[model samples]
Target: MTQLVGSLPPRWILRDPYAHQKGIPRFPRVVATVLAARGITTRPQAEAFYRPHLLPEYDPLLLPGMPEALRRVERAIEQRETIALFGDFDVDGVTSIAILHEGLAPLGAATIPYIPDRFSEGYGLNLGAIRTLADAGATLLITADCGISSVTEVAYANELGLDVIILDHHTVPEVLPPALAAINPKRIDSPYPFDELAACGVAYRFLQVLYEHLGRAFDDTAFIDLAALGTVVDVAPLIDENRRIVTRGLEAMRAGLRPGLQALARVSGVAPERFTAETLGFALGPRMNAAGRLAHANLALQLLLAPTAAAAATLAEQLNALNRERQRQTEEATALAEELLGPEDAPLLFVASEHISPGIVGLVASRLAERRNRPAVVLSRGPEESRASARSVPGFDIVVAIRKEKALLVRHGGHRSAAGFTVRNENLELLRDRLIATAAEQLGCQPAARVIEVDAQASLADLDGLEIKGLMAFEPTGHGNRKPVLLSRGVELREARPVGADRSHLRLTLRDGRVTWRGIAFRQAEADLDARVDIVYSLQRDLRGDGVELEVLDIAPAAAARPLEIRTG
Candidate 1:
């Protein structure tokens, strides 16, 4: 047994020896440690986190104006009013549109799904799109994933005599839009319990309320799968209400309900039984997003709703090809943007070029932000106005910074960490200066380096059957609920080598005494590290039938500081 160090909480080393003695239902030690660190102490809370349910505990009427919104939707459903779902072009927007269409189609309501082209019409509720929907005989207009800050566009829809219901999760403006019913958790006056729901989650709640009003019980299992996709892809917190939706959604995805989703799983080589958070984020989500990033996002939407396997296969293949093209473009653009920076360090980075595509500026900005550990903005020169995407570090609020310079922007809106805006080509320099000043003011005197939170320190001998089984309690980790990162010191390195064709990963053998483990670090082969190192990682079973292997996240030289004492039984 290892001894406990000073100031280290004794409970940190107290693993439930009988955790997995009962059956496979035993909670994994790593899972319990992570949950405990995040304030999830009770068994009931852990169970609720792992298996989310759309129970009667939550009431949609709690949302500001939800009752009125439901009343209007109920009226539209009863009268068979022509409803048009105006959605954004991203995955969340597409999934939200599909949810509303499928939920209302069986009620004899005629619904038209309209998604604006990212390159052509840009974002949000445009006056032209509204006019078109009204001309098509749409009496009720429903906006999803967008329209929270569209004060002007909503006024246009109201003037056209269109009854509008807005379901969105973006930040609310100072003055609310004058729509018939605006359903958003961000509303200052909203009484909704949870505020971290994604746009699709908001739409899902609206459907739930609609079902209740119609006195009908709708099976939402199939839709939950899509909800999971949008929620995870959109990077929503996997806790509280979102946890339930994602947990159930993953189950639905594994059961394989929709033809398109099943076909996507097959094409991506992701077995349903072997699915994990990585598969959704790295494999499935990117392919779906590819359609919107390069070409028409409607292709992905159509694929999701595809009724035939043959149709799904064709659409999936097309999306795959588009994804490949997107990768090539992204790589070229990122390399060029990096070259422009040289060695200059600013509070923020602003890169503009005629070669960059407006469709992928956001992705490029995100990558640059991660690499530089500072706020980054990537711009594509438009004919009249230049468009830019902004990504920020955790401590800085880029959206708020952009909003302070609202006088210089034609349009701008997004979350605190990520935002986008359009400005006149002549104002690019002014915008850059204003953004840097705003960041300096808001972020204080010095920018803070990123910090990694570790759950506990462990020796290789501590990773026994009991600890591994206890960690299994926390499944489906993402966003808000992250997997616990364990730091182990004095790890003797046996061998290390580059793996993968591109040499993007590192495979290493770490040992302490007779306990030896093989670990693989993804995308960290090029990182500077000595032969002997301290590693922070999450242990997972490979389960590939070739036996289990440990996966490492971060590795650095073992410092000469005081050693961590551990008490093990």
Candidate 2:
């Protein structure tokens, strides 16, 4: 690949053999090895991992603040109160609002789904929105994907005779908001077994409990797809409850997508049967987010809640246009960020410019962070204040680092790996300096190289039949859980050349003994391939209807590769 200056080469780490491999003897050797690597060593564990619906479903009532939130929702329905559903402009937030609105409307709740304008309101609950809702006869205000840190805003809502219920999954602050019920699994005293649900997941669970309390059977098949979309798009860890939700949701989607999603899939050129975590992250998620990034999130939300195919198709096309514009803007912003960064290496990358849009700062930060292998902060400088987004490397906690300088911030909240904040222009330079010093103290002069974990070492022949099928069991992989990588040594590279319109991808033909395979290495067009090389790859469906193909991740010249020590402890 075209290596960036100061970027460290990726370190390959092969996992040690699973200690309890013998417990899952029913699986093929390769399948068992890969399953064991993921901690599924027993038959029951394997069954549950492969068929997630077999896993135990935690009681929604166990979630912290569930009872209060549920009872308040019931009361609002009974009284026919106008409930204002406030959500963030992101996919998770929009999906959360859609779930609550669709679920509650059938029960006689007068719902007003509202997403703040990205330019005027930024993120979370704003005083102006609350006042507007109150004026429009909204007695109950429920926030999705936001409001956990909106202590002042919640108090203001309470003053306006509006009862606020916060449904959020972000990192909670030290002091709780004054909402009627602040529902989040991250609470210190939360009894909920899983703490990693996306905001949409939380909204889904609330509806489940609400339905049961009202003696109605909640249809998971109808709503799980939205939950899955939000979970994958928000980059929530795909384990435990999240795995089950996505597994079931994908099944439902394959069975048949809702009208809105059907139109969206048609526009995105994705078949429902081919739905995977990658589909949500790369296709649907970005398109949904593009509406908010370039225009208004309501456009995307309307598409999600569209009741007819005809209406949805037009909205989907509009969103597709917005997504294209968003992609162009992000590319321009990323290029500007690179230019501003120049040819230097720093413990942290910080760039601020009026040219960058507030909506695309997060995307810019994410791109720079991945390219430079360190934490990155990108800010769109407003006249008096700047909106900033921060993305971090695997081990670095970007939000925690930002929280240290909360005194300089107007508002900030997010997960460990990602965060956003608003800062007065006067404090921007000092905040950047302090953050750089903090990162330097922890990361030293240069950040460590990224590591790619390999599940097993297998020949090209070993990855066939049951082995390929077993690998398919790791579907819907993204973020925390990824497709397993296999290493094959000294494979003959028959051909290698740049592909794609932009020549950013490599098309390769390789052979191992009598078996031959075609591979594509994305964004690695500049990698110098050898005639005989060690290749690290994952199996993926061949889009051309040819069976399976290798998604090459990395390559090295023959036996020159010296991997890091295997972890045995």
Candidate 3:
């Protein structure tokens, strides 16, 4: 996984074993070892981890302003007041808009969904946009995936005789907005249970509470599927209620139930029965996000709002084509950013160019940070202002770093791992310097190392039928609840060759005593497979409907300290 051509290999750290010292009825050994490595020691925790449940969702009324927001929405429904939903331009934002609009549609509410242009309006509330919405006869303005940090815009909305309800999940800014209801779980004073919910999760909770308040029963889980899409797409942790939401959502999605999903699956070449977290996060999410990143997000929103199968199929095709274009642009932008970086010793990297699009800065930064293993800030410079997207390593909090430089920024907000901001072109130097200094303080002058973690050291015998079924118990895997990565030593590489059109992947046959395992390592076409190796891998079903295959993450020659006799093709 360490791709730097001449760099020393990263130290692989296997997770330490759990005590199980209390003699707590030692679990089915192999499965217990995996579960214990992930911190699920108790039997009840194991049960909850294995079987995710959505029953008895936390009360949304516990949210600081949810009850008040519900009351206002109820009144709006009774009086038939015009309502507008202001949403962000990403998949989470799009799904939030769809969920809220669909949730309120049956109540005779006059709802209009509005997504701001990425180039023109950027993110969150703006006074001009508020004036436009109010002018368009919107008496009530509800924000989805945004508006928590728009203190000024909310104040203006209030002055224009428009009641605003802000439903967001981003880290709260110091100064709160004066909206009629700002219902973010991350509020400093909030008593609501969980704070890690994606924006769409919050929106779903609100709707669920509203349904109860209206004396309505909704066992229909189609909406949960929407929430699940937004949650996984936004990279929300799949733990606790988030796990339940995604698991149930995946169940609904794989059933080929929702029109939007069915059409999207058809265009994306996803067989519904085979849908999983991988399909959602890698395939569907990126296509939906492609429209938002390259053009207007309303195209993605329209796909969700599509009524007919043909219309949905057409929108999905459009998005698929746009995604191809996005990939090309992203490759160009990433190469540009890499070319602009300084020496390799720097703890942080900041790259700016007019060549990169404001919409794609986040994508570029994410790629740079993941590849080079550090915080990266990619800026797209405009004539007057520049938009910067920041992505950080696991330990550093990029959001906190961005917050420290707020005085030099026009606007900034995001979670720990990712963030975005706008800065005046002239203040770019000051912003850059401050951010560099902050990263140094947060991460130290020493560089962050690239490390691939292994969950446990295992032998081929450990992966029996019991372990396989136990592993399957932990379904709907993604962020937080990740699939385990195991390392096995001294595996004989019987045969290896490059696969794929670009010859970027290695298809290998590995042997363990009498048993044999088939595997593929991504981006390791030139790997040194001539020598016996230790492999880091995950167990997965073969793509060809065969039994289990090993998905190789990395391979290190058996003798680590000794020089490798690598073959040069």
Best by TM-score: 2
lDDT of 1 by residue, 1-569 (tens): 21212112112232232322322234555555555656666777666665667443578889987889888878887888899999888888989998988888876679999999888888788999999999999999999999888989989998998988899998787877898888998887888889988889999888887888888887889588878888888888888888788878887777775888878888887788666666677788888888888888899899999999999999999888888898899999999888887554567879998899988898999887876667889999888888899998867888888888888988888887778888998888999998888777766434344445566566766777767765644557778776666778778878779999889899989887788999898878775566567777776657472345677876766654323334343
The 10-residue segment of model 3 with minimum total lDDT is 560-569
Off by over 4 Å in 3: 1-8, 19-26, 561-569
- Order of quality (lDDT): 2, 3, 1
Clash count of each predicted structure: 12, 1, 0
| Model 2 lDDT per residue over 469-496, tens place | 8887788788767897888888999998
Task: Give each model's whole-structure lDDT.
Answer: 0.79, 0.89, 0.83
| Residue 325 shift from truth in candidate 1, angstroms | 1.0
Q: Which model scores highest in lDDT?
A: 2
For candidate 1, what is the TM-score?
Answer: 0.91
Lowest summed-lDDT stretch of 10 residues in model 2? Answer: 15-24
- TM-scores, each model vs. reference: 0.91, 0.97, 0.95
Candidate with better lDDT, 1 vs 3: 3
Error of model 1, residue 332, in angstroms: 0.8
State the weakest 10-residue window (summed lDDT) of model 1: 2-11
